[model samples]
Target: MEQRHPEKRNDRNTDLTSDQNLKDRPERQESDKAEQDPGERNAIDSNPGERKPAEPNAGERGSRERNRGERQPTERTSGERQSVERASGERNPGERNPGERNPGERNSGNRQGNDRNQRDKDRNEGVADRHEPVDRVAPDRMAGEIAREGRRSADNGSSERQDRSAGERGPADRGTADRGTADRGTADRLVVGITLGDYNGIGPEVILKALQHNRMQRICTPVIYGSMRILNRYRNILNLKDWNLNGIQNISQASHKLTNVITCWNDQNHEIQPGKVTTEAGQAAFACLQRAVEDLKAGKLDALITAPINKQNIQSEEFTFPGHTEYLAHEFGVQDNLMFMVSETLRVGVVTGHIPLGRVRSSVTRERIVEKLNLMYQSLKLDFGIQKPKIALLGLNPHAGEEGLLGQEENEIIKPLIKDLREQGRLVYGPYPADGFFGTRSYRDFDGVLAMYHDQGLIPFKAIAFDEGVNFTAGLPIVRTSPDHGTAYDIAGKNQADETSMIQALYMACDVARRRKEHQDLEANALNPKQVVEK
Candidate 1:
C-alpha cells in the first residue's frame, strides 16, 4: 500500500506538467486551437505556474500521454490486477476479451481450481509410490509384509465408528465387520502332500499324530501319501478318533473349497506290520514318495514334506538312493541341490553331502562355494522368510588351521571365495573351525552356516535342535523339504517318537509353496508389465 502511493502521485503530477508544457507548442495553430476551448484556456490562464513549467515541451508531452494510454499496465487495479495475472496465465491459451468476466471472481475461481488440482496431483503421486517393488527382496518376507499391511488396514475400528454413527439401525444390532480385508485368504485351504519317510521308522506314526489337531485343517488340506492301512494302524495305536482324514485318489477327489478336511492319498497297496524292516515295506514307502512327487510335478500338490526316511532301508535291491533329498533331487533332475538343516535358532547348509571325509577338502571350490552361498541366501529368503540373511562359513581344518598352520584349506580356497562374495555385495562371514565355531555362541549371529561336510554341521545342529530340526532342499524348481532327523527303526511302531519336526516340516512346506507362487507371480508381472494396471 505504501509503495503504491508514489506511483499514483507521479501520474497526477505528470498530467499537470503535460498540460502546462502544451502552452509552447511549435504549431501555433494547434496551441491556439486548444486555447479556443474556454475551459482549457481558462485553466491554462489560471494556473500560470503550471503553464510555465510545461511551456518548453507542449507537443511532445501531449503525444507521449497518448502513446502511454495505448499500452496495458503490467499490474492493473487491485481487483483487475488479479484478473490480469490469472488471465495472463490462461490468457495465452487463446484470445482475450475486454469484458469476458468480472476480474475478482475469475481470479478467485481459477486460484481455487489450481490449488485443488495441485493437492489432488500430490495425493495421487503419494498413492502411486506404494506399489513399487523393493528389488532383491525375499519372497516369504514380502508375503509377511503384505499380510501385516492387510491386518493393519483391517484394524480401523469400524465397529466403534458405527457406535457413534447414529443411523436408524440399533447400536446393538451391528454385524461383525471388524475383520475387513483380514488374512482370510492367507489362512485359506492349501493342499500339501505329506510323504511318510519309511514304514520301519517313525514316519507313519508322526503323520498320524500331526493330523490329530483340528487347527491343521484351517491352514491346509494335508494328504498322507502312504497306505490307508498304515495310517489307520498308527491311528489305532495312538487310540485317537480325531483323525478327520478323508481318502482321496487324486486332487480331484479332495474338495478345492476353503476350510476343508484333510485328504489322505492312498497310493500304495501293501500290508506291513510295525517295527518291521523288510523289502516290501521299503518298496511301499518308495511308491508313496513316487506318487507324491508325480503329483507335485503335475501341480496337484503345492509341495512335498517327507516325514523321515532311512538311507539303509531305502537301499534295497530295487531301491538304491542315499536319502529322500538325494532321491528327489535325482527325480527332478536338479543339479544345484543344497541341503539346509534348520533349527529354531540356527540353520546349516552342507556344501557336499554323503561323500567321504577325505574328499571334503578337495570338494570345496571357489565356484562350488559361491554357488552354495547363493543357494543358502535364496533358500533363507523363500523357505524361512528371512530378509537380509547373513551366512557364516566353517573351515575344513581344526582351528581354521591357525592361518594354515594346521591346514591350508581356509587360506588357499575359502578365503578367496569370501573375498569374491564380499565384492559381489553379499553379506557373508567367517571360515572359523567347524567344531569350535558351531559349539560357541557365535552361531546366533548368522542366519545360515556353510559346513564342509555332513556330520561336521549335523553334530552341533542336532545337539541344539534335536527334535525340531527340518531339512530343506534349496534351488529346486519346486518346493521340497523334509524332517532333519533320520528314520528311527528302534522306536518304530513303539509310539515313543515325537512329531514336532514332522509338523514343522509340513508348515514349512506350505510356506515355501506360497512363496514359490508369489515369486512366479512377481516374475510374470516383471516379464509382462501390461498384465497389471492401476484403475
Candidate 2:
C-alpha cells in the first residue's frame, strides 16, 4: 500500500475587506453607537431626585430643527429610519428609555457581526462546518462576497478529501476499496506459476520477499518453479530461512496455504555467485522458465508471473528471442502482441519493442500501429473490463512533427489512422507530443497510451512507475506478465532490492486471468443467449 502525505492547509490570511465594507454602512453608524458610553445613561438616573425639567435653550431648539430639516419627508420615510436604527442598535429619537428599542425591530447588525466572528473562528481552527446555514439577512453584496470566499476555502481544503473519506470508512472498508467492486467473473483462487529468473540476480530475493506470507494465497496458489537448492543458497545469504519453501513435484501437488516450490533442475554441482551472470546461471534460469511455460500451456496453471531475466545469457536455440515478451509471443504462435506495461494508475503500450532507434521511424507504419491499437482496445475492454476505452496515441517525431516541419509521420500516418479508427467506433485520439502528454499528466484522463517506440514509452513508464510496473503481453493466447525490469546484477544479493514491482506483477496476473475468464464467459453467453452459462 502507498503511504499518503498530509495535506498542507492554506494558512494565508483571508482578505475580507469587501465583507467588512458592507458591515460598516454609513446609515448604521456603528462607530457613533459604540462610542456612546453607558456611564452617561447611569448618570442621568443617579440624579433623578435633584434634577429639574428645563425648557429647551435656543441653541438646542435650533439644532433639533436643523436635524429634522436634513431629512426630506419623501426621502427619509419612517420605515427606513427605523431600519437604520435597528441595524445601529439605537433607540428612536423620541423613545422614553435609553436602553429601549422598537418592539417590531431587532438588532440585525449585531446578530450578523456575531455570525461573522464565529465563521472566522471556525476557519482558523481548520474546520469546514457546512451545517450552519448561510446568513440570509446579510445584504446582497455581502452575501455574494461570502459565497465566493466559501468556494476558495473549499478548493484549498480539497486535497486530502479522499484520504479523509477512507479514514472514515475504516480499515475494513479500505480493504474493500483496495479490492475493486467490478464484476470480475468468479472469485475462485487461481493457480499462478512463478518462474525464478537469473537466480544470481535479485530474482530469488524479490520472489521470497513478495511471497513471505499467506496473504497472497487468498487470491491465488503460487507455485515457484526453480531449484530448491538455489533458493536456499540465496535465502541463507539474505537471512530469510524462516520463510517456508514447500516443495512440490508438480502443480497438482502445490499447497494453497504455503509458498510452494517446484525444483526444475538439480543444483548439486552448480556454483552460486551473487551479482554475476554466467552461462550456468542463465541455463538454470532457462530451465525453470521452460518448465513453467510447459505447465502453463498444459492448463496446469492459470497465469504466469516471470521474474527478471538477463537477455544476453538466456539466448539459446530453444529460447532465441529478444526478451520475454517476444519469447512468449513465439511460444503462443502469436504474430502480433503488444508490450503493455500496467501499473495501478497508468497503462502504456509501445508500437516497437527491443528495436533500434534508427528503425523506429520505419517500423511505425499505419498497419502496425493499427494492429497494436486493436490489441490494446480489446485488452482494455476484455482484459481490463473497460467498456469503451479511450486511448492516446503518441507521435513518432518530436512535438508531434510540428505540422510536418520536423516530421510527417503524425500528419500522414497517425492522424489518418486515428480518423479511421474513430469512424469505426473506436475512441482513439491524438498524435500528441510525448513530452507534453506525460509531463502534463494528460495520460491520466485516458485508459491507455501507445508510444511510437520503445524508449519513448518504456523510458517514461519506468521512471514514473518502476516500483510497481508489470509488463504484460497482450493479444496472446495465454496470459504472461513480468516485472518491468531486468536482472539488477549489481544489487543481486545485497538484500536491498525492492519487491514492490514483483508483488504487483503477481497480483496483476491474477486480476488479468479473472478478467479474461469473465470476458470469455460474457462473450459465450452473448453468442448463445438461449443457453445460460454457469459461473
lDDT, residue 529, model 2: 50
Error of 2 at 374 (Å): 0.3
Q: List the residue pairs that clash in candidate 2.
A: none
lDDT of 1 by residue, 79-130 (tens): 3453466566765212334334433345556655765554345333422111
TM-score of each: 0.62, 0.64
Model 2 agreement with the true structure over 1-535: per-residue lDDT tens digits: 2322211110100111112334334533554365357753343335444433573333332232323233333343344454676577766434424333322223334444665565455434322222111111122222224324333323424423322332345445544544432112113457899999998888999998877633354356789999888888887888875445788898888765567899888789887898998988888889998999899889888999999888989988888888888888878888989999998788999999998888888898999998999999999987887899999999999999999999999999999999998999989999999999999989999999999998999988998999989999999888889888889999889999998788778777877787777667767767665666777
Top-lDDT candidate index = 2
CA RMSD, predictions in order: 23.6, 19.8
What are the lDDT figures for the candidates, one per model?
0.64, 0.72
Clashes of 2: 0
